[model samples]
Target chain A: MVTLEDARRIIAAAEKKAAEIGQPMNIAVVDGGGNLVAHVRMDGAWIGSIDISIKKAWTSRAFDITTQDLATHSQSGGQFFGIHASNEGKVMVFAGGIPLKKDGKVVGGIGVSGGSGEQDSTVAQAGEAAF
Target chain B: MVTLEDARRIIAAAEKKAAEIGQPMNIAVVDGGGNLVAHVRMDGAWIGSIDISIKKAWTSRAFDITTQDLATHSQSGGQFFGIHASNEGKVMVFAGGIPLKKDGKVVGGIGVSGGSGEQDSTVAQAGEAAF
Candidate 1:
């Protein structure tokens, strides 16, 4: 179970990184239970990125893998070629989602959107650092 | 729009109230767009309340009124007698949902479940106070 405090700190760190990069972003965090813990859309962030951010967090927590890895695995001729079609389309096989671990066990996940894949991943990495 | 911090504080307040009332609960918060912002299910909370709580928050934001008030309006032969059938069944006319307003504009909503209607309302009220 991730505390609300943990979620808040993660989002704050992610938001700071986004501002530093001169980008607005949508960020999401989910607890071990795969339930939303926190989510934010910075002023001027793309509205379309909201659900993407939340689903990225959920997908990471549900699969216990960073979305970058998932994307690689889901590539054509790879092990999870059609995984994106599952989970009501909530499985986002893309960068910017990372699981949060505590004592070597996944405790939550963080996701970011509204920027390039590398930028989003960078922001999500900042969020993960808070844990 | 309710920030992630706002949602976290609201959930914290709701959780505290639920603990004091000796009732485990599922709580959900949604932004002005009626998108999920945060959610939590305390240990031992009824699993059935998960979707109900989210929908309750959605209903509150969609209508800009408390779910309790919506219930009165949805009674048979009332002005909105069959309103529940609309919105893909996301409408929940109950006592546990409330809208969060800022500067007189409806900005978000919170919902609580897994207890009696009165108990759920009490917990939801605690969340509303966070804003």
Candidate 2:
């Protein structure tokens, strides 16, 4: 159910990690239904990453898979080639999204952007750990 | 959280109003997360109206304002002139959408289409009344 409070906590942890890496990032969380719960764009984060962050969160929960993994299959000639064109172009098939699980079941998702894929993934992982 | 039942009720009311006005219409509802909950297209409704209806619902909730009012600020040279280009084209700055409120706090939105802006606004208002 990813209550707003829970989203805030996750975002806090993600923000901290982004800070540790000296990357201003955009972070977003989505509930079980792949609906946005909360989002934050750290000071100095790229404004363009705002929508990407939210879409990445949705992509994570929409498929219950990290967008990093989704990217592999969404590339040219891959199993999910052209998947990024789906969901009104809201499927962000790249790094920085991780599904939140409770009792080993996906309940929500977190997404981070505004940095290199690895940096984004690191912050997203921090957020997932919070959940 | 605008439950499915609530969306159904709102759509039903909007449909009735559209019928009364002799206008087949497209109606949509979205929850607090700006995610679609329900939608309906009456017989003879414009197919193009379907997407508009859904986008209107999402826009209302996303900005916590009526799309009719959004239209005002979104006009050329207006305060939000280029805002429609934001939100990945999900922002519909026109009539036909209204924010749903509970205890003065926005909880969801309803959108209607398939007629003039005034007609759509009327139908949307009826849906809002139901909530």
Candidate 3:
């Protein structure tokens, strides 16, 4: 189970990394059920990204893959094209979302926003390390 | 005008109140534009309340009235009976939301869920007071 404590620990690690990189962020974590466990928007993070962050977390878990990978198949003429229109508009095909795994099994997900795709992915990876 | 710092302060106060009452809760804060600023779901709070809390905050700011009061006018046969069906289901006519006013003008809102109507409103009130 991805307990709330685990979510908090992950958020703290991500927050620290974002601080070190001098970027504010919106971070979210979801349990195996793809339900939100916790979320935070660091001061100065874009308010517009709040929804994107949560949707990205859900997309990562719902597909059991990093959103960057999903973006590949979700592009024009790709296998999962138009997937973003599914899930009532909750599917986010982009970077910055990574699935959380335990014992090599997908257990949850993390999403980060407020910077370039590479920056967001780096922060998300940092949070995953805390899992 | 509700910065992330303000949102955190509001959430902290609401969380404290929820804990004092022994009810884990979902809390959300929204800026004047009805955009989310931050949200948290206490360890054991219902996952379902996560969306509810966010919507409640938006609903309060959208109408500039406490959701408790809005609930009355939103009931069947009342003036705003179908308002909830509007806003793409983002409007919540409930008792857990209250507007955050700055110098008598609504500036933001706070929402609390995962308890009885009275409990939710009480917690939201504590958060609003912090602003």
Top candidate by lDDT: 3
DockQ agreement of candidate 3 with the native complex:
0.64
Q: Where does model 2 sit among the CAPRI classes?
A: incorrect
Give lDDT tens digits, candidate 2, residues A3-83. Answer: 756887898899899999999888888778776665666756776787788888989999999999999998999999998
Q: Please give the range of 10 consecutive residues that has the lowest summed lDDT in model 2 chain B.
A: B35-44
lDDT of 2 at A48: 78
Residue pairs in clash, model 1: none
- Candidate 2 residues B30-59, lDDT tens each? 778776665566656776886789899999
List the candidate numbers ranked by DockQ, top first.
3, 1, 2
- Per-residue lDDT value at A125 in model 2: 98
Winner on TM-score (1 vs 2): 1
Candidate 3 lDDT, tens digit per residue, B1-131? 99888998999999999999999999999988888888888888998999999999988899999999999999999998999899799888889999999999999899999999999999999999999
Arranged by TM-score with the best first, the candidates are 3, 1, 2
Model 2 error, position A89 (Å): 0.5
DockQ of each: 0.30, 0.04, 0.64
> What TM-scores do the predictions have?
0.79, 0.55, 0.93
